[model samples]
Structures are given as structure tokens and as C-alpha cells.
Target: MKIFDTLNTFMLEKVKPLAFRFENQPHIVAIKNGFIVLLPFLIIGSFMMILLIPPYPEDTTSGFGQAWLALAKELSEPLWRVFQMSFNAISLFACASISFYLAKEYKITPLHTAVLSMMAFLLLCMPYQNSSADITYFGGKGLFVAIFIAFYVTELKRFILRCNLSIKMPKEIPVAVAQSFNTLIPILAVLLTIYPFALLIEHYFQASVPVVFEQFLAPVVQASDSLYTLLILTALIHLLWFFGINGALIFIQLWTPFLLVNLGENLKAFQAGEPLPFVITNGFWDFYVTHGGSGGLISLCILLVLFSKSKLCKNIGRVGIVPVCFSIAEPIIYGLPILLNPIFLVPLLLAPLVNGALAYFAHSLELVPAMVILVPWTTPAPIGAYIASGGSVSAAVLSVLLIILDALIYYPFFRLYDKICQEKEANGKEITQ
Candidate 1:
């Protein structure tokens, strides 16, 4: 026990400095900021995924299957056909943003720089028109190259400005030579090392993993008919989001098969008047499909209360409310200090689990109908929950109650965050004065 405790302390001590360093680093800071700014794109991507991926049905032979399947097929067919183009567009946007940022660092005309960046992005993303293979060799590989070039150009300009380097033809030769060398070496290395490997992995994984996960993991999760698996998966989803992976991606990837297999069991249990899944039974809202979120009104209210206190908190809180209402919390989760705050992290992670479990319990007891309808995740909280649960106003009210509960859960942590911010501000004032 003493050894274990000592090891734990040592680990904590090691982690703190690294965490602080990461939080302070400019690149890390930029990525976090960029992520918040780019979140709407991610949300858009998730919606596209949902529209493109066919939802699994409970019955395959029925007339509903024919109708629903036809609908699903029609929506998905065009998306799948044009998926490469869509992916290229997304990559180009990311590259463009990186270029714009790099240009700003060099004190250049960002508009001109961005246009150049976009051109490079397009060049990198354009599909080879002459290729005979069924799959177009999209130059998705060039995205990083574009970003690297942008950064290199920005840095070179900075260096030249600082040193007052001559731009005459003779002097420009050496600068151009140096820039060429800088760009070529990394570009070649990436092409030789990373590009082939990335392509290989992408192809291999694309061929195998989705099918395996669907056939294997889906059934195992569904077979148990236990709420614990769902809880674990939801927790995993939250953990992934914490690491900057979109939570919706995780949900959409695993949800169809998992939902198809288990939802039927859950609904059967609900109809038979037996114990329902633990999430709906215990929590006021079901997160997976019923509501875009778990804590419902409780969590929202808690955040609102927190927002009312501090300027930064208030601003982020206000901005995040609309997204949160639709079960999207990326803005709040990242924008707020909740990511690193020990006080907030506890509830940030646990509150959802608690809510899921409660919702499961409530659902099992037939206190609420098993959620059957598919609603968009971006729909507002109570309204979304109501519509998703077959227009249950009671469910909407419960969602409101859950949001209030979340507020209570979040209050103490918010106070802690507020205090920390206040102290930091005070210290800044002292230094300034």
C-alpha cells in the first residue's frame, strides 16, 4: 500500500508539469482554439454521417423495411458516391486554416496568403483525372505539405524581416535555395515514410475493421441486455471527446449496430413491463438516441448558473447554450476550463454516467417509453428529447428536470473555477499595478 501510494504520488508529480507545459504551449493552445472554431464543421460532418449511414432496422422483411430502406438508400447513395470529394473539401478547409494562421504570424497580408494556401490546398486535394483505377488517387496526401509550406514561408519571411535580408536577384537565389531545401527535405521524408504507411493503414482498416466491429462487438454488447455495457460505451465516448476526438463520431460509428441489437431488447423489456435499461431507468433522458445528451435540463441549468458569475464563463456559457440544447457540448467542454480543472472534471465525466444510469433505471421500470424515434442531435434539449421519445411531453419535462440536476452537479465545480480565475486576475492586476 505504501509503495502503491508512493508510485501514485510520483506519477501525479510527473504528470502535473507535463500537463502545465502542454496547456501553455502555443501549438497546443492553437489546436484547442482551432478545434473550438472548427467544431461546427465537425458537427456538420456528423450530421452527414448520420444521413449517409443507413440506420439498422428491427425487422428486415416488413413493408416498413422496404420503405425505410429505400429512403435510407436514396439519402446514402449520393453521399457514398461523392464521399471522396467531401473528404477532400474537409481536408482543404483544415489546411487553409493552418495556412491563414501561419501567414498571420509572419505579418503578411493574410488574404493573399490564404488565397495562395487555398490554391495549394486545392492542388493537394485534387483527384488525378487520368487515373484508370476505380478509386481516384485523390491528393489528400498533400494537405500536410501545404501546411508545412505555409509555415516555412511564414518563418522564412519573419527571419528575413528581422535580419533585413536583401530581396535582390542575387540574394534571392540563396533564400530560394534555402526555402527549397527546407520544403523538399520534409516533403520527401513524409512521402517516403508517412504517406505510404498512412495509405496502407487506411486501406487495410477500411477493408476490415468496420465489418468486424459490426459483426462482433455489436452482438456482444447487445447480447448482455445489461445496462453496464451501454454505460461503459458512453463513458468511453466522453473519454474520446476529452482527447479531442468528436464524441458524435464515436456514437455514429458504433450506434447503429449497437442500437439495433439492444434497442429491441430494451423496448421488449419496456413493453413487457419488466426492468428497462439502467440509463433511461435512472436518468431523466436517454443520451444515445433519445436525447443528444444525458444530463438533460439539470446539466444545462448548472452551466447556466456558472455562466452567470464570471465574464469568460458567462460568455462561453451563453455561446454554448444553443449547442448544448441540441446535445452538442463540444464548445462548452473545450471552451470552459472544465478540461483541466480537477473540480469540474469529476462531474464533467461522471455526471453523464450518472444520468445515463438513472435514465436506464427509469426506462426499465416503464416510467418512460423506450425511445424509438430518430431525431437530429442538434435539436434543442427538451424538445429533441420529447420528439425522439414519440412526442412525450413528460419526457421533455423530465429532460428539463435533468438539466436542472446537471446545474446542481456543475455548481460547486463552477464556483471553484470562478475562484481560480479570480485569483489569476488578481495576480495579473498586482503585477500590472
Candidate 2:
């Protein structure tokens, strides 16, 4: 009880304010919004990836699976093309999207700013010789570079505007030409500042900007993939949620780059028929650890709907059932008013932690393939599991298993909470609103 009191004090006095500021910070906001704009493109690429390797096993006897595999083989070239253009160009899209949103946030010209960001990104990451350079940096590997470029361009533009650093054409010059002159300073600034670093890195280290960044950050990336890291992240997000903060979205900002890079690596290995190089990815977090939303709220909704005796409890469950199926947690969190609710706290922290451990070990032991495809988080967990696993029956079954386990974890907690609701209802305190 004393520990809870101490924690409650610390959360309210310390972590809560920091979480709110982080959730609302402009750069972080831009990052979240930027990713939203590109979700459809990633989904399309992942769909193509799944088609490249038929979900059915290589030894499958299913007639439909065999026919599909044949068709996939026939269209392999086209499939690879689409996948390469979209998913493989993740960092490029990320640079553009983040810069565009950040520019808008600062009341600048978003379209032109986004283009400038890409221009700088390419100058550093691309090889000098036209045909010799592989596009290794254009994908998830270049993500950090893309982020830096996005910030650099937008902030540079902001500084130029602040210092009145544009080339002003005479009044008689064409309006379009005058607008074009505005971009000259940023372009030159890019060449003068970032271009030198790119050249130096190449000349001395024989590496591109993205490569150096990836190498510098490599150890951190590898560490983030472990079960311990996953559990800590899971706990942090759920803990914040218990106090009425948007912990999931907040953590997503920090985790997205790592998740995207891992997903890219896995995609490459899967395409080459090599072992998947990662155990952590968007699919792992979305479908396995946080299925039905963070903290396994989907499991709680099922318990509320099927078993609660309280009318208010059952109705709340009915309302939340659909959203949680799609991996949204708002309906249950707000409806059940789980925020600051002591009875629900233990299950809130424990369920997803259990799920994360299960998923990490399951994939580690090779009971199922590590996820290659990056399915949308909103996809129902069971369906996302099968698709993300490239049709692994065991992975699909594992998803169901996790959800059941989550429900079992919540069963006693939900029963205790529901009894209170039942008693309150008898006293005409039926928990409405």
C-alpha cells in the first residue's frame, strides 16, 4: 500500500506531466501525423510481399495454395517492382511526410519544404556514380537520416525566414520565378553545410551518411529487440495508460524508427529465403503483445460482455467489443473508466507483459516464422498474425492462445470489479456515464 502511494505520487508529480508534454510536442506530433499519411503505402507494399511467397507452405497439398503459388511465381517480377518502389523507399516517404507536416505546423509552405528535405536526404545517401550505388539507404536503413534531413530542412527554412535570407527578385520578374528564388538559399545552405559532411564521410570512411548512422546506432537497435526491452516498454506504456495518458501513441513515436528498420531487414531476408533477422517488429508489437489494444483490453471486453452480471458492465462491454476487435482501446478504457482504477491496475500491467514474453519465446524457438510483413495495427490480431507470419498456422494459433491467456489473467479482476458495479446498481448507482 505504501509502495502504491509512493508510485501514485511519483506518477502524478513526475511522469504524467512529462508524458503530456511529449505527447503534444510539435516534432513528435509531426512524426505521428507523418506516419499516418504513409500507412496506406506500407500496407500496399506488405500485401505485395505476402503475395511473393505464397502463405501456404512450400510442401502444401492444398490445391488453392498451389495455384496461388504458381500465379505468384509468374508475377514475381511485377510484385518485386511494387514492393521495391513503396516499402523499400520508406525513408524517402518518411522524410517528405515529416517535413511536410512540420512545415505546416510552423505556418510555412509545406509542399516546397517537403521537397527540399528529400533533396538534402538524397545528396547524402545516394552514391556519386549513377549505376554503382545500391539503394540500401532508401529503405528503413535510412530512417534516422531521413528524420535528420526532415528536421534540418524545415528548421533551416524557418531560420532563413527569420533572418530574411531569401534572394529577392526585382518586381518585374515573373511571380513563379520569384517563388523559385525563395528556395535558392535553402539549396545552397544544404550544399554548404550537409554536403561537406557527406563528402567527408565518403572520402574517409567510404560510407554514406545513412550507413554511418546505422552503424553508430546498431548496438542500441540490437538491444531494443530483446525480451527484456519489450517487457519494459510494455510496462511503461500500460503504466502511463493507467493514469489516463495516451501511452501507446507516445511510445509509438520513439519506437517507430526501430520497428520500421527491423521490418525492412526481415522483408529483405524473407525475399532472399534467408532467416528473418529480427524478432521485434510492428507486427510483433501490434498482433502479439498488444492485441486488442495495449494491455490486452480486448480480453477484458470479452469477459465483460459474456460474463458480467451488471447491466452497466455488460453494456460497456457491448460497446467496446467491436473497437477492441480492431485493436482500439478507447471505448473500454473510457467506458470502464479504468483510469486511476486500483482494481484494474495489476491486470493492466501483467497481460501485455505475459503476451510479449510468450510471443518472443514462441518466435525465438521457431514454432512460427518471425514476422516479415508489416500489417496495420488496426487489423484484428488473429488475422494480422496469420498475414504477418506469412500464413503460419502456428502463429495464427499462437494469437488465439495469447488472447485466451489475457482473458484468463483478467478474469478474477473483472469479476471483482463487476461485483462492485452490481452492488452499486442495486443502490441505484448503476454506473451510468
Best by lDDT: 2
Tens-digit per-residue lDDT, 121-236, candidate 1: 34333433566332221212232344444454344444544665533345556764544443433334334543454346447775322233344454555443456766776675
Error of 1 at 67 (Å): 24
The models' CA-based lDDT, in order, is 0.49, 0.89
Reference-based lDDT, residue 333, model 2: 88
Each candidate's number of clashing pairs is 35, 0
TM-score of candidate 2 against the unseen true structure: 0.94
> TM-score of the candidate numbered 1?
0.44
Candidate 2, 388: how far from true, in Å? 0.6
Candidate 1: stretches off by over 4 Å: 1-221, 243-248, 261-307, 429-433
lDDT of 2: 0.89
lDDT (Cα, tens digit) per residue for candidate 2, span 62-105: 99999998999999999989988899989999999999999999
- The Cα RMSD in angstroms, rounded to one decimal, for candidate 2 relative to the true structure is 2.1
Poorest stretch of ten by lDDT in candidate 1:
134-143
